[model samples]
Target: MSRLLLSTLVVVVVIVVVVVVVVVVVGVVGVGVVVVVKVVAAAVVEENDYVWKNGNHAEKTYLFLVTNTLT
Candidate 1:
């Protein structure tokens, strides 16, 4: 009976660990997707390619410039 209980506990622990790992991986992947989408959308909307300073003006640029400048 003790052995059976131990085995059940172990199984439960393994299942919990697996679930936590999966959740973390999914969260990380979701964040990555959001960042990529934001970047791509910014690039498409800005119409001024990121890192291109040619013929640049202050106000016409997108919000990326402010963050880029700070970085």
Candidate 2:
């Protein structure tokens, strides 16, 4: 009976650890995506002279700017 209980406890501890790890990884990735989106938006705003009404392809615009700067 004690061995059975020990096995059950180990399983529960492992499940809890897995859950915590998944949550932490997902949270970090989520924050990183948000930061990247905000940075791109800010760059677009600057390129448009602080106006956010440009109908152009901002992602391509930024890519072009980066490509130009690299070469």
Candidate 3:
């Protein structure tokens, strides 16, 4: 009976550890994705400034509105 109890306890502990590790890994990955997205968006905006400036007034206004909403 004691051996059975020990094995059950070990299993529970192992499951808990695995869950915690997975949560931590997912959290790190989520942050990394956000950082990468922000970096890519910034790069695109920098490279497209002239394109935006050359667009019509209505297009420029819509672009600014979208960019403002995002930030």
Best by TM-score: 2
**C-alpha TM-score for every candidate:** 0.65, 0.69, 0.65
Q: Over 4 Å off in model 3, which ranges?
A: 54-71
Report the C-alpha lDDT of model 2 over 1-71, residue by residue, as the tens digit: 99999999999999999999999999999999999999998886586563334435785677568757976
lDDT pick, better of 2 and 3: 3
What local lDDT score does residue 23 receive in model 3, on the 0 to 100 scale? 100
Clashing pairs in 2: none
lDDT at residue 5 of model 2 (Cα atoms): 100
RMSD (CA, Å), each prediction: 5.6, 7.2, 3.5
- Which segments of candidate 1 are over 4 A away from where they belong? 48-71
Q: Across residues 19-41, which tens digit of lDDT does each residue of candidate 3 receive? A: 99999999999999999999998
| Candidate 1, pairs of clashing residues | none
What TM-score does candidate 1 reach? Answer: 0.65
Query: What's the lDDT for all of these models?
Result: 0.78, 0.82, 0.90
